[model samples]
Target: MARDYAARCPVYPVRNAWLVAVAVLLAAQEIGAPKVQVAEELEAYPTESVELSCQFNDGGGLTKLTQVSWIWEPSDGHRDNIAVYHPVYGQSFPNVAFKDRVVFLHNSLENPSIRISNLRMSDAGRYTCEYATYPTGNEQGTTTLIMLSKPKNSANGVTVQAGTKSVVVARCEAADAKPAATIEWLAPVGGNHSTSTTSGPDGTVTVRSEYRLVPTPADNGREVICRVNQKTQKQPWVYPIKLSVEYLPSVSIEGYDHNWYVGRSDATLVCLANANPEPTTITWTAASGPLPETVVVEGNKLTVRKVDDAVNTTFICEVKNRLGSSRHQITTVVIEALEDPSSAGVVAGAVIGSLLALLLVVALIAVLLTRSRRQQRRGYPSSGDSIATGSGGSNGGDYGNKARLLFSNSGNNSSKNGTGTNNNGPIYTYREGCDATGTLTEKANDYHHHHLHHASTGNAPTAHDILLSSEMDEAERRKFDLDDSMEEEEERYDRFGGVAGGGNILPPAYHVHRGHAGEEMDVYLDDDMESQRDGSVISRTAIYV
Candidate 1:
């Protein structure tokens, strides 16, 4: 009977307070009035269940409940029946699907509550509950139900390239919510970014944020986050966007500014650069001069085998990547010729000094050679003038005054050579010079090997040698100027013939040859005295008688 009344009875929505008061008055019926109430509002998320209850006089004595009816009135539609309930004849549902999920919490006749399961966005509206009493007529109340839903896969990662005049846009959505969500975008580098939001018919909001980034090397790996905040969610949904940037190479030459000499050393130039997706190739070129003979290029390194042509050249090292190319220059100079005045002065001075030293050495060698030849001809020792005195001839080492030598018998010319005693004496010949220099050693060497008897037994042979008497002016007794080439010749007169005239000052003797008996000429000792070998210092004095 209750199921039939619910299926045939007409129900009106409790739209306003006036309709609610009328239903309360009808249910009272002059008996003790019962309080009829339902939940003021219902809040639920998507895919959840909700219960609408109406408790009339819960003390259980004022009114007895017969059946319960439910109503749903959309804002744009008319009132409609949801279901009805009875206690004794078993409950019935308008739709068979509602019967399995709807359970009543009817502990007493005053409480008749119905539960709705698997609610959707379309179920979000005001619901009305009407309770019929036994002694009273009927009472009705209302409840507002709201369902919250969010879009799936709404927070997706976005890839964006960061560049000048470049923009990256991403959208984040939160759907089927009671109220629209607040939208915001947070960038990694900059502060807050601007965002745009749109609402759907179901009160959901989508936030789309556009970021215009002026990228430098500093902003390569940054992230831009897009966020949407809803009242139902614990935390805001955040979508991060990737920022990729491509840039040109910043290049520099590894080896720079060098000074080198020609044909001395080689130079190597390397290109150093920093770029994304490391550089592919690096080439080296020169402003002037041909390429080196042996040129080897290895990645960033370029080696020039010989720097023979590197005369004030600017070598450019170019580095290339996918983005762009950049180059750096290294200036070099090879000194083919130097015209520095100070440096040239120093070199010239060194060369001149060397030449002077060489000339001095050659002059010394010539002097040495001439001295050597003179020594060989005169038989001299190098250290000044020296003498060996003892045995002469083959026994030159003996240091003595006189020693006899075994010469040929033909050397005996006693009549022409010596004084009255010892007619046969060792003969000697020596040449002497007056020079004070070391060449005077020739005179000393002449006396070394010759065996000459000294005049120790009697007065020595009186001899006088006048040098260059013709160059002296006899009238004025002054020396006449003579040329440097003119050498003084010695005029020696000796009175020591082999005649047996034993007088201190013998008269100048003359020997009359058999063919020229009438024309007689003076005769002297056969040879002049050699250099004294007895280490004696000889002194001469002239006495004019």
Candidate 2:
């Protein structure tokens, strides 16, 4: 059956040979032959050592160990001896390709494992461990060796000017890996990517990837990352690169505050430019006329020594780079003055004056309030007919204290009638002794003697003496009151003209009574003065103590 299948399919000749060898090995095992044990697969890196293990299992006592040998079978169907072990001659490497690089760990045929040093990519293939038994037959096992290599990674970005078309922005490569490496790109921009693979003569693979995007000025300096992954690396390798996009110079002017006025100094304007290559030339010019003589020109800056009307015009700033040139303009206005220096002072002075006026008003109000309180305490009625009452002595005799009453009318009709029943206007009242609460008291009798002396001289009390009595002594007060009363009485008498004016008038009513004390008399009087329409009058009445 094997021969028939081999004849039908000529492409499977190597498979037929493997099947025949397997059948022979199985037949030998059934007849109690030795079994050879070897690993099915192995892996190694360049410049490292590798071990190929082979062990003989003599399960059947009928077989005796003779020799053990290791062989290399490449993918091209060529076979060669790697190392051999014999009980009589020890170990020996017969293949010139593995001469000094291969050695057996044991000289005995029971266990023969060979160690190969300084491994190369070409050494990766199938290794066969064969055992020669004395009585049964030869048995063998094969192990496949695989070689791995770490790849070299690199990445770079291409410098480009802004454009509308999509183009390559960055490239990443992983070169010379045992197995082909996979590459991916990471970027902040939206774009597309492509990957390609290449193979070298030494069985190493290389992978490359490219990122493409529409170039723009805003995309410049953006980071693009390349990630490479391979079998030999524990983790993926990363490389970051920045994209470079060039463009023309963009120009702008700054530092104009509109407050540029006459006599202003240190006013300046700066020209700012953005470009890939640095700007080489910066210029300042006047758009309407020649620059003012007070203007100072520096690189990218224009300073005014002193602002004037001549500086009120359009100014232009031109910037130039390798790409092109750009210009920006600014219009300036020169005013006669920035602000009035005294205006702040005027406002502050007004505020201070208002505050002072407020304080003065408060002080005046306080003074008026104090005067009103004093008047109230002195028993001066705020509104009523002017009324004066005398006090009696301690022993019910004459108190000997007197008061003078005066009335003045400025209009034809007095504000109040003599009966004290009219309410047309305010009136006045006075009492000799009063308490702090505005209640009249009888304490005036105690000082009646002091007052009587001034009254005996035919003097009358004045409004000033009554109002300011707290500030004067009793005698001083009496003297002022008496002098003021006599003058006022004379003025009133002349103004009234009671009999000289030829008008019928009634005499004042008087009542006199004897006192309990020796030669003491108590007297009471009521006086009234009235005039016709369109007349003015003044009246005074004196009371002796």
**lDDT per residue (tens digit) for residues 1-545 in model 1:** 99899889756565676788988897676345436778889888756888788876645466677877777866566677677777776555665535566677664445668888887666777888888776758878889887777644254433443356545434455544456666666776663345566766654555554565556666666676767777777777777866665667789887644655555445677788877646888887777765555557777787766556544577788878887788888777776635554487899999999999999999999998987655433322233333221111221221222111111112333222223233322222221112211110121112222323332452222211111223212431212223322112110111111212322222232232222133433333222222323222211111111
Against the unseen true structure, what C-alpha lDDT does each candidate score?
0.52, 0.68
Candidate 1, position 343, lDDT: 82
Predicted candidate 2 versus true structure: per-residue lDDT over 143-210, tens digit per residue: 99998878989999988888899999999999989988999888889988999999876678988899
The regions of model 2 sitting more than 4 angstroms off are 1-34, 61-68, 85-96, 132-137, 338-545
Model 2 residue 482 lDDT score = 45
Q: State candidate 2's TM-score.
A: 0.61
Compare the candidates by TM-score and give the number of the best one: 2
Q: List the candidates' TM-scores in order.
A: 0.47, 0.61
